[model samples]
Target: MEPVNGYYEASMNFDMEHVRPFLSQLEEAFSLGLDVDHLAKRVAEAEVETAYGCDLHLAFEGQPVNMKFSAWIDDIDAPDLYFYVTSEKLAEGIDAEMEKFCEAHGL
Candidate 1:
C-alpha cells in the first residue's frame, strides 16, 4: 500500500488507562478484513509520556491508508485521545468502535 490524500480524525476525553483497551477494541474492529498488525505492534511498543502517538498502515480499496492514534493530557487534567484514519471506510469502522468504547467506559 502506498500513500493517499484523504484523511479523517476523531477525538474525545478518556482516562490514560483506557488507551490500551481502546487499542484492543480497535484491533478487534479491524480484525476481519484489514491488516492492522503494524498498528498493533506500534501500540504494544508505545511508551507513555506527556504526549505520544503512533501511525498504522493499511490498504483500503487498493489505496494506501494511514491511521494514527494519539493520547495526551489536557490542561484541565483529563486524558484526551484522538485517531486519524485516511480512508472513509476505515474511519467509519473505527468511529463506530470508538463510540462504543467511549460509551462502555463512560467517557
Candidate 2:
C-alpha cells in the first residue's frame, strides 16, 4: 500500500450540527463501528478558528490513522461551515462516502 503523508481540503455549505452526523455517516460507510455520540462530543468541544486544532481518527481497510481537522462558520449571515482534514486517504474516503450518502439521501 502506498502510504501518503499529504493533506486534503474541502469546503461545504453546512452547519456545525451537520459535522458530527456527516462524520458518523462516513464512519458507518467504511464499517469503522465508531460511536457517533463520542465523536459529536469531541467536535463540540474543539476550539474554533485557532491554532490549537482538532484530531479525527479513521480506519481505512483496517489500518488506523488520524487526521487533524478544523471547522468554522464561513459567513455570519449564512450557515456555510468550512472544514478540512489533514489525511489524503481519509479525505478521499470521506469525499466518496459523502457522494454516495448524498445521492442516497437526496441531500
Candidate 3:
C-alpha cells in the first residue's frame, strides 16, 4: 500500500495458529499491542460473534500516534487469519519496528 503522508504502511498475512506469536510481536513493537492481545484472547477463546476492528491512540515522546486496524478469520476447512494495519505517520516506522523486533528475537 502507498504511504499516506510519508508514513510507512504494511500488511502481513498468516494463519490462525500464528495469532499468539503475532500478538507477541505486536506487543514488542507497539504500546497498544498489549490491549490488542487481551482483546484477541477474549475473541479467540470466546468463539462468538465479535467486532473485527480495533482503533487505538498512543503517544510517543509526547506525540500522538493514532492507529486503526482490522483483522478477520476464515475457516473453510482450516482456520486462517489476516491482518491489515495502516498507520498514517509512525515515528518509529513500521518497517523499522518489525525489522528490529525480528532481528532481536531471531524471528
Candidate 4:
C-alpha cells in the first residue's frame, strides 16, 4: 500500500476454512503479543519463511499483498488457503470481517 516495507511476502498453505482463523490469530498476535502471535510483522515473515522454506504472499481483493503467513494441512492433505494482508487500512477491514465471519460460523 504505502511502498512495500519489505520485498517479501509470507505464505502458508491451509484449508479454505483456515484462512479466516489464521488471520484472526495473526491479528490477535499483533494486538496482544501473546500465544501464537509471537512474531512482529517482520518476524512473522522471517519465521514463516524459514519454517516453510518459501516466501509467503497474501492476496487481498484479488490482489497479492505483503504479509507474514502460514499454511497447514499441506497441499496434499487439504486445498491450502492463504491469508495475505498489507496496510493498516486493510488490517482494520480484516479484523471487522473476521469478527463477523466468526459470529456467523459460531467460531
* Model number with the top TM-score: 1
Looking at model 4, residue 18 earns an lDDT score of 49
TM-score of each: 0.62, 0.57, 0.53, 0.34
User: Could you tell me the TM-score of candidate 3?
Assistant: 0.53
Which 10-residue span in candidate 1 carries the lowest summed lDDT? 32-41
lDDT tens readout by residue for model 4, 1-107 = 33246432334344444453655565554442223333223233332223322334544455656654444333433333333446555556645555665566666
Which consecutive 10 residues in model 3 have the weakest lDDT in total? 76-85
* Cα lDDT, all candidates: 0.62, 0.56, 0.50, 0.44
Clashing pairs in 4: 9-56, 10-56, 11-56, 12-70, 12-71, 13-71, 14-80, 14-81, 29-37, 58-84
Full candidate order by lDDT, most accurate first: 1, 2, 3, 4
Q: Note each model's CA RMSD in angstroms.
A: 5.6, 4.7, 5.0, 12.0
Better of 1 and 4 by lDDT: 1
Best by lDDT: 1
- lDDT by residue for model 2 (1-107), tens: 23335556544554455666676786677765556677555556555443224565656678876655544533432233233554566667766776775676677
Query: What TM-score does structure 4 among the candidates reach?
Result: 0.34
Candidates 1 and 2, the one with greater lDDT: 1
User: Which regions of candidate 2 fall more than 4 Å away from where they truly are?
Assistant: 1-5, 32-35, 42-52, 74-87
